[model samples]
Target: MVPVDTLHDITARTFASDNYAGVHPEVLAALAAANGGHQRAYGADVYTARLQEVLQGHFGPTAVGYPVFNGTGANVLALQTMLPRWGAVICADTAHINTDENAAPERVGGIKLLTVPTADGKLTPELIDRQAHGFGDQHRAQPGVVSITQSTEVGTLYTPAEIAAITAHAHGLGLRVHVDGSRLANAAAALDLPMRAFTTDVGVDVISLGGTKNGALFGEIVVVLDPGATPGIEFQRKVDMQLASKMRFVSAQLLALFEGDLWLRSAQHANAMAARLSTGVAAIPGVRITQPTQANGVFAALPLGVADRLREQAAFFYDWNRATGEVRWMCAFDTTEQDVDEFIAAVARAI
Candidate 1:
């Protein structure tokens, strides 16, 4: 890890990505508080119970949660639970499962992934229907799962109504619906809806409830919303190496974050910061907003010279659409108005 001083010494520039920012204070404190504890191994401690309570509140008393290392792990483990030996999963073309999972769903879980087109990082019912073509023909891969990202990688959100529509269509077609809530907290806060408005009520079968992105350092809760729909899920998690041996510590962080509404607080702050950055960047000359800043991410096509100048300052960001020439700016829990303003000033100087 780069030293904090080294990071702080960098020139005046803010990264356009949420992942670039550091962990929030509350999460860090939870981790520190858990440092010297010797309780139980493999999720049998009080902290794990607390964390489950946190999730139960999110999805009502019927929901359960498990902590995994990362978003990808949480997603693959959760998806695998709902799939049979030969059943396949469906997702957006840009879904992390389709583009980013390194084929774990296929290689490890022995399931296929069917990808469909996405508009603004969201999958509509029309898109799902379009991709579900030729299923059960014995001539094509079967469609059995609907996996969607929230606060999608492109920083867009699916409204509760939109999710309900997609879920209804997928369920009617005899498919289980999974929400890759890797950024679910962000989407929930942005929509101003209760978590259950989309999860249990909107027809989600399983949800990879996110904690890593909003605030937690390394924890994502795989919430089993439909117990009957996904039996043998706990065993799957254990076999897949997602079951935290020291589960209490990880869960403690979540409880401290979620049970008291810290998750929404962090996500709301990040969304606000992203909005601030988007507004600032759009005002600058030669910078264009590539997408609506709906969540904690901003996509733009800045002048090449401006990008170069920002990079020279050790600013962290990524060229999301290199061929089309655009960059992705993600905001995080700790991002401040000062950071956005500084980035704006740097852009002003460069442009």
Candidate 2:
């Protein structure tokens, strides 16, 4: 029999996105462990129940987690449950929901996104106020939630104090807060704080707890920190087609991440690699580090034609801003020091 590694080029690596990385070994082992038993379906299994306790441990006692297939599903379901039929969400213009999820929040979830342009991807209370107004006006789509992305799309982070201010201001206005925490672990690792520091304790009503980008095969959880914040989430999950009939498998993968310290270790490693990449490229002339290396992602502006030249070396990454020649490179839990060094050398040679 041929080795599985020969079927594909396992040596190929990319800075495109963490989603490109394979599953963690522990998570794969967990999946195998959960496979033999005839567990209950649709989240009634022991694994799902244990996932709840594990999540509550990190997100606080009031937190309730619903496992979903992907980040888009989790975000849409969370938003749908948090809003009324005419509800709108306030988010940064660069948010994944606003720009990347292909408008799933609007088209599928039936929620309107009121996007604000920010210098960085982080949104402050002042930014939220721009779209949080016109209450009791039938003409306007009422803003019921202020959604922000942690370790935002531009690779910038919002401190705990900043998150508290946003949540405080939003809640004071009879609005709830939702965090698109796809990179939540990265934020926690970079800030040297637990997940709860910037979430449950800071007044964030709900969060999309990410796993795929960390080390899982595929899964994310929509965690309701405030019990009353998102009603009908159970039904909303099914309504949005995010319900997994074989949910124990999903739950088991998530448990493998949070039940131990794998989540933090993976995120910390990814963040460290990004920091190394940022430092390496900053020394190259004409390469401008666009955003602060706050998490596992690094954004930079490359000299014209240099990006195309770099791509020729098979070091794949995304062009963030075509107009500005800005690009994004994401590091995964599996990104090695050697990978970063090789990419840096390639960039130097391309220049």
Candidate 3:
């Protein structure tokens, strides 16, 4: 299978999302390497087996990986496995599953999502208590799980201790803990901590291990840490339509991420790029950096009409809060220092 390189314009890039970046060369190379062989279907392939082992090494021996198609699929499958028919999830109002997933969890998974407004997207035990009431109240959906995002949707990170506290609090309330780790790699990179420090060792029950946002072409996995806390995910994934029939490719991409320090290297580079972007743009007058630039995203409130003017130059960014004119700039593994410099200059000129 000769690799196809010219299928798309390689020069096309954007700061709209990490999703906009092309697959990492290493990840694509791994994908090409996994081709040309007749592997078993539906996750019965050798690559899938290898992925499980690789994930276990990072997450712990008790951890298991079930590669799925995308982040939404992983979240819905994981949250469903952690909940019952009348169960509900407690998360920050900014959670991707709550705001971005188009209600897939409620519509398809049949679980209610109880959201709490967060200043920086990180949930605490106090916030969880706000929605952690009414257990066994048949009329109200029970709060069964606390779903927290690592390097949360707003790109802020939770320290290992913060995660441990939240997990302990949730467990004491008889609710399992689920981490929507869509940017887990970024959090690990920013904190310079091992993945386990904030996950398995800290009492997290299940993880929606992300791959696409990091570097994989397209794949995410549901990693069960405390198996006793989650069951029937194997069937849950199938019922949710997240079970990839040709799962070897998905497994192969994920394996490439966890193969060596590829995940860390990519995430660190992205985070550094965001830091550089934040530093350069903050010096510009009228550009207020809103959220802490902790991970690979920089949130700022641009001067009136300045965002639109800058859009004319790059045309790829999100208005995080339209009412407040706050915008979000994302950096990816392939995002360069030159991109940051140009974007900062563009902002300065626009202002």
Candidate 4:
């Protein structure tokens, strides 16, 4: 046997995306614990079963979770199962499905996205009405589902009442509701509410529950709050190539996040770091906070040449909008106060 050697800097950090952060130690421990045992394949194992019990405790007994490999797969599978061949989804133009997924929902899932431009990366009932029409028009793709992202792409949040309003309006228009809850934990932490408070209790039909961003090595779940709203998901998961052959490991990671307070604790810390970063940077000359810091991401508009200079210092982040010189900085569960402070200093130097 050969020993593995480290290939990268162990202390390197980035605000590019939470996905860049390493796995939570607790999730790694869960993986180690689930390793030695042989379990049934393709979601028929004890760990998979236990995951359901745990999710039910959080989301209620009517909820059922199907584990998948990533957020894109979970989103595609959830939407694909909720709609028909000609069915389209209404979402904000800045949605991950519309922008970040590289058209996986369109190319892979064969679903059309009816996107509306939003100033704050959120959708209102009036905004939904923009695409909610044309139901019986033969030339148009039928609008069957409305998908909203929680702790949205620009780091904005949808309150419980806001979500409830969208759900009610969508249902009245015969459209099912889907929440792309990849940052759901951050929302829960910021709102000081449980998972179901803004979801199941508010009439959300389905959710794409995130794991990798919060603390897991890799995984997400397609949680059905209203089983009748999404049909054929069990079969569609495999059809979309999201079914993991060694399902217990995936289930174990999800359980590690949801089984206790790990999810909340990690999210709260990340959100706090983002708030700290937002507050620190807002005071700097020529830096403008562009959006509300309601989650684990901070969006700001930087002066020309500032972002490039900051990246040169090994403090990496992404440009949210090149036209506006806006950049996005994401804080992960592992991001420490020192990391935030050092990055703040770097930004000051760059400016």
Candidate 5:
């Protein structure tokens, strides 16, 4: 097999997933500048502390940040701390934890997911209870955490109030709450609320706060919010191999993002691009809209010929598992209006 990077030279670009995007300018500059500085190793650097302080303002004093290498590692570290070996995490059927992470929570963390049926990839408290109850006995998997993904896998979002309800319900049942916040900034901006509204005040125990998808080259914070729930997350991250030795690099990226509200700007740009792409794609004949462009992605049910032709024209996208017969087009911090227009033109010609 040819290495993807070896064969691919940048000619034209299209929506695929936010992960495919490059680091934002600010984040890049921070990493480049941080290269010359020597700081404490293993996350005890000034940069890491500064980022945490900034996050303290965003998520309020109720939350604390721990820099991790990527979203999966962050999720695994956060969830592992919250759940027991016999516990389960409740999530939407199409959640990233279930579909994208290759079941690492099960294979790597020794936990199970109590998958709830999701139409738009947002899991509800009702759905959680449906799966959480029957297995209360030790004979079956005990639900220890109720997990949610913001700007969910299907490009939908839950209101802050909805999240609070879900969190309250889960906590009432003695289950902790975790957010696979790989797109959390997008969600927070869309909902027009402070991060703390959903993360701390709303009762989330831990969150995998995303950075790479929005702007950074690589970094996400597994924010430990409800510190009382699960202990030893610091130790858990170290042993799980998620900790970076020269942790200042990871921490610097976050500091750059949080300090100037760059996270919000990146998320807003991505969301706007997704909306732009959705509108353009919908205008093309034979293209059927699949979901609302709520965050940084759009799902469309295009004719087979249209999908195929778009691919032929240097366009890129994913075949979403929840789409049945549609393509999932995602926007990112680097996605421009030019990209959206070019992809729309391709779709029009193909159909």
Candidate 6:
């Protein structure tokens, strides 16, 4: 193993993504608290048990939490549970699973993803119907699941009513609904709604409930909302290789996140910072805010060469659309007002 002293500096931070931020202090403390215990491995520990209770408190009494290592694994495993050998999922083209997962759903899970182009990374019933009609056709992969992202990739949100409408439509078409809730907390904070409002109560069959994006060091949970709709997820999780052997650490971190609204507090702070960043950047003459600043991300299209000049100053971010010069700036749990101010100033200077 590499020497710890040779690692990247712990003090370094960035706005490239929330994944760049370090662990939340409270989540770290919980990990330390769960470090030295002889607990059963693989989801049988006290912490994992308590996490179920905590998750149920948010998702409903029947909600079940299955902790996985990262968002990709959670999405893959959860989607697998909702499909069969010949099943396909309908999702927005901009979905993380479609754009980011590198085809793991098809490669690893043998599941096909039927994608639709969405304006703001959200899929409506009209969009769902575009791909939902090929059932019982042996030549075509059956559409069995509809997966949606909350607080979407373009930093837009799905109001609870919007999600409810999609879920209702999906079920009517014999499709079970899955939420790739990698940023569910931000959507909840933005809408000021309980998690269940857009999830269980809205007929979401399963959710890849995220933690790493919000504040945990690294973990996401597959919340089984309607167990009847999802069969054999326990086995699917193992087959996907997402089962954490030392699960208490993962469970403890999530438990701490939900202990007293720490999830909401962290998400709200990040969202606030993004709103501030968007407001400041919009004032710059050459920078155009591309999408609404709905959560903790800002999508902007800058004048040609402006993004490269900004990168020279070590302001980290990525180009969302290379052809259009659109960039994505993300905020994290620890992002501060000062950070936003400095970034806005840097953008002004670069432009």
Candidate 4 lDDT over 1-351, as tens digits, reads: 333455455548899999999999999999999999588999999999999999999889999999999999999999999999999999999999999999999999899999999999999999999999988998999999999999899999999999999999999999999999999999999999998999999999999999999999999999999989778888988888999999999999999999989999999999999999999999999999999999999999999889999999857889998888899999999999999999999999989
Regions of candidate 1 where Cα sits further than 4 Å from its true position: 1-16, 35-37
Kindly list the per-residue Cα lDDT of model 3 for residues 1-351, writing each as its tens digit.
Answer: 435786575445677999988899999999999998699999999999999899889999999998999999999999998888889999999999999999999999999999999999999999999999998788899999999999899989999999999999999999999999989999999999899999999999999999999999999999999878768889888988888988999999998999799999999999999999999989988989999999999999987787788888764798899888899999999999988888888888888
RMSD of 6: 1.7
Candidate 1 achieves a global lDDT of 0.81
Q: Tell me the TM-score of model 2.
A: 0.98
Supply the global lDDT for candidate 4: 0.94
| Tens digit per residue, CA lDDT, model 6, 1-351 | 767997765445577899888889999998998988599999889999998998999989889989999999999998888888899999999999999999998899889999999888999999999999868899999999999998899989998889899999999999999999999999999888898998988889999988998889888999998878678989888988899999998999999998679999999999999999999999989889999999999999999888888888857789998789999999999999998999899999888
Candidate 3 positional error at 231, Å: 1.5
Report the lDDT tens digits of candidate 1 across residue range 113-209: 8877766878887888876767667767778888888878788888888999999999999889999887788888899988899889888989888
Best by lDDT: 4
CA lDDT, every prediction? 0.81, 0.93, 0.92, 0.94, 0.84, 0.91
On TM-score, the stronger of 4 and 6 is 4
Q: How much lDDT does candidate 3 score? A: 0.92
Q: After superposition, how far is residue 295 of candidate 1 from its true place, in Å?
A: 0.8
For model 2, what is the error of residue 228's alpha carbon versus the real structure, in angstroms, after optimal superposition? 0.7
Worst 10 residues of 3 by lDDT: 2-11
For residue 141, give model 1's deviation from the true position in Å: 2.2
Task: Please identify model 6 stretches exceeding 4 Å from their true place.
Answer: 1-11
Model 3 segments beyond 4 Å from truth?
1-7
Worst window of 10 by summed lDDT in candidate 1:
11-20
